[model samples]
Target chain A: MISSDVIRGYNDTFLLSLLTKGDSYGYDLSRQIRELTDDAYIIKETTMYSAFARLKKNGYITSYPGTVTQGKKRTYYSITENGRNYLKEKRQEWRITKEVVDKLVGGDNK
Target chain B: MNTIREYIEQMFKGVPVTEETVQLKADILGNLEDKYTALKESGASEHEAIVTVIAEFGDIDELLEEFGVSRVNEQVTKNYETMSESDLRQYIQAKGKMGWNIGLGVLACLTGVAGLLLFLAFQSVLSGALYIGLLFLVGFSVIGIGLFIIEGMKAGELERFSSPYIILPGDKEQFISEQKDYKRSFIFSIVAGVSLCIMSITPILVGALTAVLPILVGVAFSLLLIGVGIIFFTYSGNIWSAYESIKHNGKYVEVIEKETVKHKRNKKVDYVIDEIYWPIIVVIYFVFSFTQGTWAWSWIIFILAGALESTIKSLAGSWDKD
Candidate 1:
């Protein structure tokens, strides 16, 4: 199971990676993260919005206004090429981290 | 499923859900909904599944921190650190307004003096210049008092009390105490000195020395009095923030323990007290001295009135509990 800290540290990467596939809004993005993690990781709306702001600020994502169901105009965010590259780098970092952690923790489990 | 939906709805409920926040909220909700559907399929009750999903979302503040959005109240946070804390606090207490009003008072004084001198130059046996001097003094006095009233109103207004986070920015209790003492001492010192110069100078001179002594004494007195006024007021500026903090209940002024350099977020600091505080006194003094009265006593009285005014003001300022 992923710790809360781990999810927080990686929220930006996960959101950007998800958007790189297609544009999405807040609720949908949080739902997607749960699906991908098999419910192991979930991002709150507040967390997701904050990550979106950061990603947008860093030029990794762009947001535009669009209408969703219930006549609500929602902001939709899409990943930029820069965001894709950022996700790639973060993914590599996560891989290295997982490898190091597994070696350390699984050593005794086995 | 129920718990997740409830949490999702709650999160979005009161928030503006502006375009930027909405997009992120929607994405998170979608991810949650998917999990809820899967959990329901696995035979978890709707409410249980939703609760489980909501519980996993984690702390919101940490999430916002990554985006640098957690420091949302940047203006309040920056107020203390952006300027010299002492300077900013003084600035808010309408010190600049004070300085501005003092300048006006000085101008009014000069104007009264000019009016009086003109009256003397133009006067004849038929019409004396005394009335002109009195008129000018009275006119300028009105203007000076008007400025003081306006400054007080500005200081007391609700809008001026506003800071980003809390009341006047600093240790508010200490601020109030120091301000009280400062105002008290300042007013007392000026009034006492002026009264001494006016009421006691003759007795002092008669009792002490007689040659060129009175003139020397007058020079010494002026220098000493002006010097003391400047020193006390300058020190008072340093504690002005504390005064404001105390007045504000220490809530509005956000005391920033950490330093930040962004000045745009910092509120008012380092106001010009001289502008507001000195003008009326100066106007009254110069008007009385340079206008209708040429006697040495006139100068003494002018200076004495100024001293008395300062004392009264200080007393009034200290009346507040803060």
Candidate 2:
């Protein structure tokens, strides 16, 4: 149940990481995120949708109506070269951010 | 399916419709349909699939905020209040009752017309029947118009129908499902009404040719059937009118249900609305094939609805454990 505000900054990072693995449609991406987080975080459809628009607008991802294995027309997203660079930059930023936050909160506040 | 489509449509309402917005809408629909199909294929019931898809559809304001659209400003632009869940349910239920009022009203009017027609068609046999016919017309039309005025005030809530409040998503879902169910009923009403209208004419044609049944009685039966048909239309048709004009949604329904269960409250509030809907006039119509006092039943029901509407509303909104 991480707040959207907490993750809003990294929505692109999370999405592009997944997109770099392979092209994926909206539902499939949501499904993968749900599984990957072990259900800790489930993205709302609107949130996912907004992220897609932002990614496409920023030229970080490209979309086309791709046919899935089931033969349904799906809007699929794949990470662009620019998207890959952005994800890498985010990863580096997160490494330092996580270490700094962890130290400030202590080893295990709980 | 209409529920889902309508829900999405309601969200996109008020925003300027555009090519990009249309594509976004299509993409959103595409995702939802895909998820729904997968859920169904994985053995979710139709009801379960729909609920899951809608529950997960998320908030429109979340989308609006991301896009830097000011929803608050939009509300202020119009004198709109956030419509509470109870307000919506009351509106819907009132709207449902209004349907019955109008349907019954139409029935009364038509029966009155039928009574007069019966006299006209069989004036040769029955002496002074035209007076009775005139009485029927005057009596029933007065009752019909009375019902219209009563309904005008009740559904005058229609002024608040689209205004006064924002629909939370949960309440919105409740309404969407209710509207979906009512929409199916509406289709049934259309078929039944049209069939009834057709059948109303047949008795006259058959009776005039065969002289088997009295033409007056046949005419009465014919008009009564048409009246019933119209009842179906007004009852279901009101829902569509509300659906088109409303741009609201809800999550308050879920919260209310939770509170109801948590309190261990009396959840069963079964309304015996036949007292309010199928009142004495209809009974009289049934008793004598065409009674002198048709106004007694339709307005009896109409007045009854007006009287008990408060009780129905109170129970729906504020009934506690006691």
What's the i-RMS of each model?
A: 4.2, 1.8
In model 2, the number of clashes is 17
DockQ score of the complex predicted as candidate 1: 0.27
Candidate 1 ranges with C-alpha deviation above 4 Å: A1-8, A12-32, A35-40, A45-92, A98-110, B1-95, B102-106, B121-134, B158-322
Q: Once model 2 is optimally superposed onto the true structure by TM-score, how far is the C-alpha of residue B75 displaced, in angstroms? A: 7.0
**Residue ranges of candidate 2 with Cα displaced over 4 Å:** A1-110, B1-78, B120-126, B163-165, B214-217, B247-322
Across B1-322, the per-residue lDDT of candidate 1 in tens digits comes to: 4556577666544332233334556666665676667678999987788777776565665544553232324445444322233433565455645644654654555455445554554465428567976787678767766765776676555333343223222344555666676786656655654554355345335424655444434433443334334333334442453355445433432233232222112321212224644566567766875586433355455446556755754555455315
Error in Å for residue B316 of model 2: 40
Docking class of 1: acceptable
**Interface RMSD (one decimal) of model 1:** 4.2
Q: Please provide, for model 2 over B1-322, each residue's C-alpha lDDT reduced to its tens digit, 9 standing for 90 to 100.
A: 6767888888876643334455667778777887788889999999999998997888877776555433333433243344655656666677778988988998888888888987887788888889988998999999999998999887555665533244455446666776777777788877887677777778767776787777667767877887897787777777665654343322132233333343233223323333433454456545645455332233334335546755874575475524
Tens-digit lDDT string for candidate 1 (A1-110) = 66666556887888887887789877677778878889776666556666777788799999887676554556788888898888889999999999899998879767
